[model samples]
Structures are given as C-alpha cells and as structure tokens.
Target: MSYARIGKGRNLPEQLEDDLRKAIVSGELAEGQALPTEPDLAQRYGVSRSVVRDAVRLLIAKGLVEIRRGKGTFVRAARGEAFAEALLLALARNGGTALDIEEFYGLLLPGIAALSAERASSGDRDRMLLRAEAYLEAFGREALDPSSDGPGLLRALFEAFMNEILKACDNKLVELVGGLLVRMRSFRDLAPEEGAREGGVAAIIELEERAIMGLARAVAGGKASEARAFAVRLCELRPSLRARLASTPAGDMPKLSFDMLAPIVQDS
Candidate 1:
C-alpha cells in the first residue's frame, strides 16, 4: 500500500508528502475537495493515522492543501495568486544575484524559443510579427531620444515569444520557468536608448525582426530544425547584446549600470 511505503522506517512522512502532492497536482484529489479522513487515509495507505496527519501537515506547508479544523484537508487551487507570490518569494530568496537569474534564462529561454518555433500556430506567427513591427517602430523613435519606450516594447516582444512557448511546451516545469523569466525581466532596467545609440537601434530592430520572422516562417512552414537553429542563434546573440549594453554610456539616465540587469537577461 502507498501509505505502508511511508511507515516502514523509510521516512514515511516525506514519501507520503510526495505522493499526496503528486496526487493533488495530477487531480487525483480535485481542487477544494476534502481529503479522506486520517484514519481512512491511514488504512488505505497501510500507515498509522499519525503518519497520514504528518503528510497533511507537509502538504499544507507547501501550500498544496488547506486544513480546516474538524473539517478535513482540501486541495488548493492550481496557480493561485497566493501560490504565485510564494513562488516568487522563494525564487527571490534563492536568487541572490542578477547572474543567478541570467543563468536561469540561459538554461530555459532558448529551448522555449526553439519549441515555440517548432509548434506555433498561424495566429502565434501573426502575433509575433505584429510585436516585432511595434518593436521596430519604438526603436526608430527612441534612437534619437534618450527616453525611448524601447524596454517596454522589448518586454512586449518577449511576451509574444513566451506565449508561444507556454502554449506549445505543454509542460508545467517549462511554464513555471517561463513565468520566472518574465518576472525577472520585469525587474530588468536596461538603457535601451544607449544600446540603440551605440549599436544603431535600426540595426538591432532589424535583427529582432529577422529573428521573429525566421521563427514564424520556420514554424509555419513546418521546418522544425530551422526553427530550432534560429532560436539558438537568437539566444547566442543575447550575451553579445548584454556586453554591448554594459559598455555603452548611460548618458543622462544616472550612472545606470548593466551589471544589475545582466543576471536577469542572461537567465537561461
């Protein structure tokens, strides 16, 4: 029995916790549904009632379930706002530096882009193209002015790319990573005008447009390999872009530093 596996001097509480967590996430125990009574669960799992209680406590600690006094334990809603806040807090605690965030991006974004390129639908392609066009327009206007909406535009484009991945990856782990990337990106304070001034905003915009178009065309044409390669190349350019931004002057925008932004940008 599953509960017996926990009780045989084998760290039963932890094992039960894992099992119950999986069951909740997989919908074996539906959201808001009460868990079986401690005695019932204990009997079902071949464990003591105390072990079952310990498992419930563990799940509650993880925010996977809620216990009502004299009621029972109930599954929590999936991706609840409270859960998001807790997850972000946990990430922030673990993420001590910008480099840590960058390392995370470095690991995930390219793969997400590749998968997006491989699986995006026509609507996704159109949405990405529209965002790319908007980015180009923002770049052109912000090239001359120090105060350009370049970062905001770039964020929108990032979302366009990310939405494709979230829709196609069909993996919760990937989705969670993508969400973290977005959160990190939100905290990124890049001097886009400086990068535009130094590297020619028009040229950067063209590169971004090309990347978006490349992925769109590849996915639409069912060219998965080409899509994957395009994504890899795009990811490879991010490091160079960060290097360029780091070297560029901040002009009037304080002594804005890229070091702080590097980790978030570099996160895989």
Candidate 2:
C-alpha cells in the first residue's frame, strides 16, 4: 500500500491517518484483522503513542475501524456503508450554498463518472442511458414543470453514480463524499424561469447524457483520466447554474434555512 506522501512540516496525526487509511484501503490490512497495539504502531511508524492514538481516533470517527474493549482495533466489514451514511448526514446538516456543494461535486463527480465509464457493465451503462432519456423527457413539454422533476432527475443521476463505487472504493472518506453529493441534491431549488432559460429541463437531461456517454466511453476504453476529466467539467456546471439563478429576481426564490434541514439527519 502506498502511504500518502507526507511533505516536510506536515502535521503528524494527519499524515499518520492518511498512511494508515491508504494501507487499509489497499488491502495491506485485511478486514477483521487486528491492527497493531498503540505502542507497537507508534514504534513502527516512528511517532509517539499519543500521535498513534490520535490517528486511531480519527479513523474511528470516520467509521473505518472499531477499537474493541480489551482487544485491538479491528477493520470494519461494513466501513464504507457506515461512512456513506455518516457523510450524507453531515452534508445535510452543514453543506452551505450551491457553490459549496458545487465545489465538492467538482472534486468528486468527474472521478466517479470516469470510473463508471471505465468499469460500468453493460447493464450499468443501459441504466444510466435510460435515466438520461427520462430526464430529458421530463423537461420537454411546456406544461411540464422543471421545479417538480428537477430534483428527482438529479437524484436519479446521483444514485446511478453511487452504485458505481459504493462497493469498490472501500474507503470511508470516499463513501462519505459520495453520500454527501447524493444528499446535497435535496437542497437544490430550480425556479421555473431559470429552468426555461437553460433549455427547459431538457438541457439537464442532455447534460447527463453527455456526461454518462462520455464516462461510458472513457471507462470502456480504459481511459481513467479522460473519465475523471469529463466528470470535472460536469461539476463546473452547478456553480454556473447557481450564478445564473442568483442574478434573477428575488421573488421567485424559495425560503429555506439551515435550521430547517437539521432534523433530516439528527438521528443518524
């Protein structure tokens, strides 16, 4: 397993956690395997026991491993699943503005798209294409409201993307980001006028089609970098859309607040 390259003057705990996490995700440390004791890990990593403890705590908080009482820390069998839920909850509670979410999507969506392109089965590609067509259809008629189907279409896209890596990444951090992206769509608001201007919901479908097709081709061709780049371009669209919406009249805007979103994930 390749440890995260640590630059000079990097924080100890952060570096240690990065290395340990990479090791776990790379299968250097198998699931259900006991990690070395704090003292041993500290000595092996050339850090103080305190630093090792902090790193362990960081991993625990991410739901990566469990420190059993009187036993060593054990890799979680369902770490990725647990992390996804936790991340979604966190984003629902704390994710601000369309811009903030857009930035995250910029970082994640393209990579997922690329991965889907490279690794998606025929069934997966078909599913994405079908969803893209539905999304396009949803925006077609004048009577068809963009606000009504916009969120749902976006949700579908997110779900399709989620299926690509929900099992493969096996890293809590990656899963958390995926869950956050999925949950963030709930906060999006599409005013009628804005939707019409951007090709009346059809544009979104078109965009998805392009993204999915690009991803499919990239993945099928084993072009991981190309797939990732396509996703990054798609991610840029959110901020662009947000900017356009922000410039329009205020009366069309929906009344939403962070307080209103808190309860959705309070229990989780």
Candidate 3:
C-alpha cells in the first residue's frame, strides 16, 4: 500500500485526515482495501499513534472507512453518504419546503440532463434507456390489474430512472444533489394529490411512461438542449409540485420524515 507524503503543517491529525481523505477519494486507497495498521501509519507519517487514531476517527465520521470488530479499518466506497447526511441537516435547519425543493430541481435537474447528454458514455446511455424500458414493462403489467399498486410502482420506477440519469451525468455535485429526488418522492406523498386525470391510476401511469420514454430518447440521442427541454416538460406534469412552488407557507412547516412516506396504492 502506498502512503501519502506527510508535510509539517497545522494540526498533525487534521493534516493526516486530509491526506487520507484525498487518497481514498482519489482511488489510491481503493474501496474495501485494508488500511495500514495504526503503528504503520504512525511510523510512515512520522506521527504518534494517537495522532493517527484521531485521523482515523475523522475518516470514520466522514464514512470514508469502516472499523470492523477484530478486523482492520477498511476503505469504503464513498457513495454520497456524507452528502446525503449534510443535505438532510441543511434542509431541516433551513425549513425546506416542497416548493423550495421543486425550485431547486427546476434549476438543477435540467442541467443534470444536459450534462448527461454531453458526457454519458454509450454504456451509460444504454443503461438509462434500459431503465425506462423496464419501467414501461412494469407499468404495462400493473395496468392490466385494477387492484395493482400502480402509483407505488411508478414512484419506484421514476426514482430509479432518475438515479440512472444522475449516474450517467458523471458529475459528483449532481450525484450528491440528486438525493433530493428521494425526498421529493416523500413530499409528493405528504398530501397525496389526485391522479392527473379522471381516467385514474392507469392513465396517470401511461402518461408518465410516455414522458419518461421521451426523456430517455432525448438523453440517449445526445441532444443536450432537447434532453434539458424534456426534463422541464416532465417537471410540469407534477400538479403538487406546481401548487407547492406557487405559494410559500407561513410559520414552521411540519417536519417530514421519509420513513413515514409509504407507497400510495389506491384501488380504482
């Protein structure tokens, strides 16, 4: 295993933490790889074991490493766990409302789509299109049964599709902020808006299937402008989002927990 060159600086522990974090994030310390023993790290960095322990503690807090009982500390694949935690804290502190989230998306998601169009590899594009296709197949099966969990299924599918796009975008910031999509699903379930039409759940599913297909095609075709435009069009279909965006509520908003947001399966 390669060790970072330690230079004299501020707090030795903090500098050690920075060095380790950079190594982990840069793939030098690969995921699941065992970190050097505390003694080895201390000797390598010319620091005391206590300083090494402090640095390891910081890495643990950041989700960069996992300490196993009787096993050594191992590097973790940093998959936005820290970002999600930070965003949740920020949202809670700032009184994040549904409209606030939607507005953020209005600015963020289209850009994400455009970036996906520009940067996505062929495999990434194929995977995105495949997710849309899978959604259609799942929706088709669900549509035949009046008692099916159409809305719930669609929510899952939509989230999955968007996640694929986020991955395709190949941007760390986009991937981090993309976590809001999960919270947005929770917000949508908060008040439970009616299906977009009288034709009921199946109709709603059909419309969403079409919209997602259009989005997939634009993204896969590598048309950045069209992909972004399609994302805007998809956002317009959410009546609840529109309503939330139009008015800001007064006083402290009710706290929303993603845990309580159950999938809405209604009988037609």
Candidate 4:
C-alpha cells in the first residue's frame, strides 16, 4: 500500500517515523500486521531505503514493531516497557528526584487504593496479603541479622506489594503509571517520616506494613473506604524517607523544584 509521499522536512527520518507512529496509534496499522518491506516503503514514501530503515529502527526502539529475519516487520502490541524507560529517562534528565516521584505517588496512592478495594479480585487480595506477610518476615529477619539479604528482600517485597495493588486497581493506564512510580522509587524509602518521627522510622515502616495487611484484608472483605483510610494513613506517615534524601548532595543533577516540597516533608 502506498503512503502519501512525505514532504521535504527538517529531518526526513523523524518525519517518516512520526507519520508511521501515528498510523500505529490510530490503528491504521495494527498489532501483528506486517509492515511493507523497506524497499517498498522507501518507494511508497519517496525516500531512500536507508531512510526507511532508520524510521523502522525508531519505531522498533519505541516498541511499536519487530523485524523478523526474512519474515518481515510486524506491528507489535507494545508492552509499555520502552515507553516507561523513555519517560523515566526524561524525568531524570529534567532532574526529577525520588522526592518528586514520592509526592506524585502520594497524591495518587489513596485514590488507587480506593479503586483497588472496589475492584480487586480474591486472588489479588490474597497475593497482596502474601506480599505484606513476606515483608514482615523480612523485616524481622533484618533485625536479627543485619548482614542478611533481608533488607534486599524488604525492598523487593515493597515493590511487589505496590505492583500487586496497582494490578488490583484493574486499570491498565493506572498500572502503567504505578509501575513507573514503583521503578522511580530509589528504594531508599523502605522507610518514611511524615508523622512517623514520634514512632521512629522503623516503627513507622512496621506500622505501615500492618496497614498494608489491613488493606489486603479490607479488600478481601470488600471495604473500599477502609482501604482508602489505610492508604491515607500510610501517605501521611512516609516523610522520613525524605530525611535521608535531604542530606544527600544533589550531585550532577540540577537541584530545583523539590525544595518546595522540602518544607512540607520537613513539617510532616
């Protein structure tokens, strides 16, 4: 099939890539469908084979298509990993910090929790409970053996527990954003301080763990309001993780924006 000839432009490869991307997004192209071969695409677009190859490469990097050896290129059902990686790269380039991600997630977690409560399946609830229980076991082991892998287990469990909750929310867009948030986590916050100073960081983390357990139970019991309450409490209690971030040098990344949240995190 002939595509409209791309007009002369600032960058031929980029323009071609954009046009192809639009076709993919708008479903002019479809998942698992073969794309025109390079020579054919080059002829159709009135571009060189090299330009077609470059455009296809860009689409591949974006996770839109895969080139099969001899079989040809096919539109892919993008899993969002490449997109997530690009977003995170942009965020880091713009000096996005752990605190920035935390605050952003803070704004969303309560709502996510409420939605999960309303929609989570029994399996989701069961998995969440398991993750919560595993974290507690890791926490106890960490206390007893400082050098054990328990700390690492704690971090993994933390991410897994959040992943489970995000999945339970049953919204693919939310799950993607939440997955980014999970990755954006420095894991430095295996602890938070907001109102947790009185209880101490470790104490606060344990309390939050119990709340997670409670949340899973609430979801199982079909209590959306209770789930949101647990999330809000966890949100209000997580500022301590920011304490460590505060003292850490900004290093090469530009230091801007996060200072505004500094006072709020400190006040918490």
Candidate 5:
C-alpha cells in the first residue's frame, strides 16, 4: 500500500500511524485485509518493530484494525456504538433534556429531506414513497385501539419511513445522527396537557401525515426545496402534537424494544 511521501517532522510512531491511516482510509489497505507482520512493516518503513507495534496500537484504538492473536491484524469496519453511547451520556451529563434532542432533530430534518430529494435514485424514491404511505396508514390506525400498542406501531412505521429517507440521503454521519435523535424520545413521552381535545389531536395528526406524504412526493419528484419545506412544516406541528398527545396513555406506547428498529437494521 502506498502513502504520501514522508516528511521528517513527526515522531516515529505518529508518522507511521499517519501513513498507515492514510493507506486504510484511501482503500489502499482494503477492509478485512491483514497487515504485514511487524518485522516486515518495520523493514519496509525503516522503523523498529516496537515503533510499528505502537503505530498499530494507535490504529486499533481508532477502530481501523483488529488483532486476532494467532491470526493477524486486519482492517476492520468502524462501528458507532461506542461513539453514540459516549455522546448520549455526555448530553445527559450536561443537562440536555429530551426537548433538546427534539429541537436538534427538528433542525436537521429539513436538510436531510432536501438531500434525499436531490440524491435518491428512482428506486430509492419509490421506496421512500412506499414507506411514507405506510407510516401514514399506521398513524391512521392509532385511534382504532387505544389499549393496543398502536402508537408504538405508528412510531415504528414513522421511523422506518425516515430511515428510508436517511438512507437515500447517502450520508453515513447524517444517518447515524438522525437515528440517534429519533431514539431519544417520541411524542408519547410528552406530558398530557390539560384541555387537549380529541378533535384537535386528530386534526394535528392528519396534518402531520399530510406533511409526510408531501415530503415523499417532493423527494420522488426531485423537488429538493419542496421536500425541505415539508420537513419544516412537519417540525412546526410538534408543539401542537405535544399538547394533542398529552392525554395519550403510556400504555398506548410500546413498553419494550421490539421490531421498531428492525427495518433500518435489516436494510443495513
């Protein structure tokens, strides 16, 4: 694998790490490919085996490689679980509430929708429309049985639709952030505000579903700004939704993690 021509400024280990990292990120060192033996790397880089080991250790900590003891050190796909946990913990420790996450996601959704509109292929657009319709249908069934986990099911379908949009956006970091935000909380978590009427709740839910359909249509039609505007319109309904769903019983929501995230995970 090739790295940039060496400059003699950094410490030995750091320099080696930088070159190896470049190689891996540039796909010169392919994923799941084993690295050369320590002595071989040492000889190739004109460094001692100890320096090579230190560099490899650095790569391991960066999630760029895995050691299999008797097997060898191979490149690994990076996962965001540790990053997500650390970030979520940091938010909690810093006194960030669920509303903070909600607002954060509200700000992110428009861009995501716009990106989906701009980037999605015809097949992706078709899937986006299908998922959006599924979510709308699920939401309509929420009032059919309050005792059932209808709200939870609706939430799942909504997440699945958004996951499709996120995937269509073709950005891994954006997808991860959006996924984390959705998991932070839902409308069911909001306190039931007094004077929330059934009529008002139904109206708000209808409006929200319409916005979802609009977003999907905009994406399918390649109307980026229209998709973004639909997303913003959806966000605007949140305050009303908080009041509307205030009377929704906790029992109406899912009690455990079941198949809610299965769609996204399965596709991944």
Candidate 6:
C-alpha cells in the first residue's frame, strides 16, 4: 500500500484517521485482517502511542476497524457500509422526518447522477440498466397482471433502483448516504392526496419508472448535465414527493428498523 506524509490541515489524530481511512477505502487494509499494533503504527507514523491509540479509536467509531478483547484490532466491513450503519444509528437516535430526508436527497441525488455520468464504467452502467429493467418488469406485472404483491413491494423496487444508481456513481461517501436514504422506508407509508391517486398507484409507478429509466440512460450515456436535469424534472413530476417533504417536521421522522441497518460485507 502506498503511504503519504500526514498533511497539516487537520490535527494529528484526525490526520491519522484520514490516512488510515484512505488505506482502508483503497483496499490496502484487507477486511478482517488485523491492523498494525499501536506501538508499530506509532513508530511508523512518528507519533506517540497515545496518538496512535486515539487514531485507532477514531477508526473504530468510523466502522473501519473493530477491536476484540483478546485479539488485536482488525479491519471491519466496507467503509461505505460502516458509514451507512453509523448514519442510520444517528438518525434513529437524533430523530428526523422523511421529508427532511427527501430534502437531503434533493441536495444529494443530483450530484450522484452527475458523478455517475462522469465516472460510471460500462459494467456499472449495465448493472443500472439491469436494475431499471427489473423495476419495470416488477411494476408492470403488479399493475397490468394480477399479483399478490402489495404496493410496499413496488416501494422496495423503487428504493432498490435508486440504490443501484447510487452504487454506479462510484463515490463511497455519496453511496453511504444513499444507502441510508434507501433504507429510510418510512416514507413509503406516506400516502398521496386523494386527487393525486386518481390515476391510481400503477400510474404513479409507471411515471416514476419511466423517469428513472430515462435518468439511468442519461447517466449511462455520460451526459452529466442531462442526468442532473432528469433528476430535477422527476421531482417536478412528483409534486407529492416534495409535498411530503414539506409536510414532514424534521424532528418527527419515523425511526427506521434496526434490522434494516445491518452492515453489508463489501468485497474489495
């Protein structure tokens, strides 16, 4: 693994944590492998053992490393999954509304689309198309054909599709936040106004699916600006989404299921 001299912007511990995190994120530190001993790290980094300990503690909190009582500290799961789990716990304890979360997406998703446009590999784009196709098929079957699947399943499909787009974006930090949003399933229960339901739930699903597919294509084609625009226009089509955001009190957001926040093991 390549190493760089610690930068001056942050304090020693923060700098230490950032360097360590980069290594972990870059796959220099393999998952479940023990980290270097504190004494060894201190010597390598030219810092005191206390600073190494503090840095390791920070890594522990960030979910990049885990400590066993008898065994040494080891790399945890994927950094992004760890970050998502930590954010989920924070939301559960601090409390926030679904709309508040939507507003966050307004800020988050466009950038994700733009990034995906710029960074997505051919394989990444293919995965997105596959997910979009899956969403369309599922929704079409439920709407056009008789099925036992509930609206909740369609909601899951929507979240899964969005999650795929996020993964395609290839920004780990953004992916972490996107994972939290996908699992924030409470808003799935937020119903539209009576008039909005006139076209029926199938209509909503169809419209959303079309827009999502278009957005995916835009990203796949490497049209960064177009991808961003498609995302904004999608929200315009679903005023209720923005309405739900407006109506939700930030602190009153529902607590998501802890089971949903479990860390996923990421293969480096």
Which should have the higher lDDT, number 1 or number 4?
Answer: 4
Off by over 4 Å in 6: 1-29, 34-62, 66-74, 85-95, 142-147, 150-160, 185-199, 237-268
The alpha-carbon deviation from the true structure for residue 79 of candidate 3, after best TM-score superposition, in angstroms, is: 1.2
Question: How high is each candidate's TM-score?
Answer: 0.54, 0.45, 0.71, 0.71, 0.62, 0.59
Clashing pairs in 5: 192-246
Write down the RMSD of all candidates, one decimal each: 7.7, 11.4, 6.3, 6.4, 8.2, 9.1
The order of the candidates by TM-score, greatest first, is 4, 3, 5, 6, 1, 2
> What is candidate 6's TM-score against the reference?
0.59
Error of 6 at 229 (Å): 2.0
lDDT by residue for model 1 over 10-58, one digit each (tens)? 6987888888887887888899998878888888787788888888888
| Model 5 deviation from the true structure expressed as Cα RMSD, one decimal place | 8.2
What's the lDDT for all of these models?
A: 0.60, 0.56, 0.69, 0.69, 0.69, 0.67
For residues 1-268, write the lDDT of model 4, one tens digit per residue.
Answer: 2387886746888888998999998888988999888898998899999999999999999999998888999999967878777877776677766556666777898898889888888898888888878866775555434447634566687788888889998899998888877666544232221222432445434554566677667766668898787666555522444654444332222122211221212211
Residue 82 local lDDT, model 3: 68
**Model 2 lDDT tens row, 1-268:** 3433334598898888888888788888888998888887777777788988999999888777898888889988753556555654564466445445545666776666555555666665556555545533443432145445555564465455454443233445556666655555443343445334433244444444565456545655557788676655545443345664334332233333212211111110
Tell me the TM-score of model 2. Answer: 0.45
List the candidate 4 regions with Cα displacement exceeding 4 Å.
7-11, 26-36, 66-77, 150-153, 188-208, 237-240, 247-268
For model 6, residues 3-82, the per-residue Cα lDDT tens digits are: 35554667888878888888888888989989888888877787788888998999987778999988999998774666
Q: Please list the residue runs of candidate 2 whose C-alpha ends up more than 4 Å from where it truly belongs after superposition.
A: 1-96, 116-118, 121-126, 139-150, 165-173, 187-189, 198-208, 238-268
Task: Give residue 31's error in model 3 in angstroms.
Answer: 2.1
